[model samples]
Target: MKKFALYSLFAMASFSSLAHAESVLSFGVDPTFPPFESKTANGNLVGFDIDLGNAICQHLKMKCVWVETAYDSIIPALDAKKFDAVLSAMSINEKRKAQVDFSDMLYNTPSVLVAKKGSNLQPTVDSLKGKTIGVAQGTTQEAYAKGEWQGKGVDVVSYQNQDFVNQDLISGRVDATLTDSATATAGFLNTPQGKDFAFSGKPLTDTHYLGEGAAIALRKGDADRVKMINSALAQMHKDGTYQMLEKKYFTFDVYNKKP
Candidate 1:
């Protein structure tokens, strides 16, 4: 009789765990990058990525739970099963591919150098040499700056988030910053705090550093979930759901250029 009771408890616990996992789809996001992910004055998480994530969940018939995570720790947290997937504005690069699998490209945008308006700084090693540039830590921008510009007499500074990078730039602590063009425009340039800043030079496109563009990052071997997300995304595009969500935030076609 005691043996039967032990087996019953084990089976019940296992079923409960599976049940909880299927009830909700958790997505990890760092709400510091505006236009993609950011919190409002009331502490509600709202942004382009947040809406898109919810749409993906709706298509899958699952409840969406947003997990607030720091940008630098998102991947490690994902691997620890802290969340089912990461919806942060994480670029799908070669270095990241070794750590986690990615869904199809979510959207493609370019990296740009933001500096004081009329600074006349070009996005090149020689032009930025001996200048202090800030970038969010643990991002492709930081990797590119450190790897390509650090050796060329550039002083690259790493910050925890994009807002901090913008802060330092506004305060004159850094000569410039490297960030996503669309994000810089929507999150900073169009805002009051970023009035004096503008993108310098042209948009940067490096396959190795920037990867194939942003996508939904998942753990390796989560093939089933990946397929579900990709399929839902394709349908969203076909059914005009993507356009509706996109026009709510951006006026231009963010999906025009694919990587």
Candidate 2:
């Protein structure tokens, strides 16, 4: 019957739609770092990295799923298939490259030492000889401080998250905190609580510890995913989507010029 034929065609179309449903890309993020990725009071994730990831997903026509994970263990979680990639403002360096692949550069910023105004503290070991410095655990800042200052009489304290490090710094528990210059400016120095703090020394340029810039971290051997992300990123750059997002969070260019 004609009615039966119509029903059959409709069912087939529904099946096809289900079979071709949009794929999903899950990104792991540690929401402790603000102006990058952090949770709102309403539990919504918002930041430049979140915006970037969402844009990539939109370009790829995939659903975006954000997985909250600690920064220290995000790599392990990615390896365990807990997420497809990490978009948590992770720096791409030889050390991290050994464990995972990374997309093209996202943004680059320098690391600086933040201390009370007029503290006259430099990042040098001699200046901080008897002082305490706070650093986020599993970050390049922690590695740099521990390697260069810890054994040289500078007490380097490691906090689980950057927020904790900032809190301790405000409480005077730590003489200073080493963190990204942009974050120090936006998340701390710009706030009323940070009114008395200022960057102590010049930006640290030891690529051995600081790495080059931030990028999306993917699981090792996930070349397909990496390629897909790179393609989307290229399109974003070509269409000025990247610059649009960058302007939303930063006044200066976070995407450093390539050599």
Error of 2 at 214 (Å): 0.3
Count clashing residue pairs per candidate: 0, 0
- Clashing residue pairs in candidate 1, if any? none
Q: Write the per-residue lDDT of candidate 2 for residues 72-174, one digit (tens) a residue.
A: 8889999999999999979877899999999999999889999999999999999999999999988988989998999889999999999999899999999
Residues 110-178 of candidate 1: C-alpha lDDT, one tens digit per residue: 899999999999989989988999999888899988988997899999999999998899899999999
| Candidate 2 vs. true structure, TM-score | 0.90
Give the per-residue Cα lDDT of candidate 2 at 104.
92
lDDT of 1 at 62: 82
Clashes of 2: 0
Candidate 2: where is the Cα deviation over 4 Å?
1-22, 257-259
Look at candidate 2 and tell me the lDDT of residue 213: 91
Ten-residue segment with the worst summed lDDT in candidate 2? 13-22
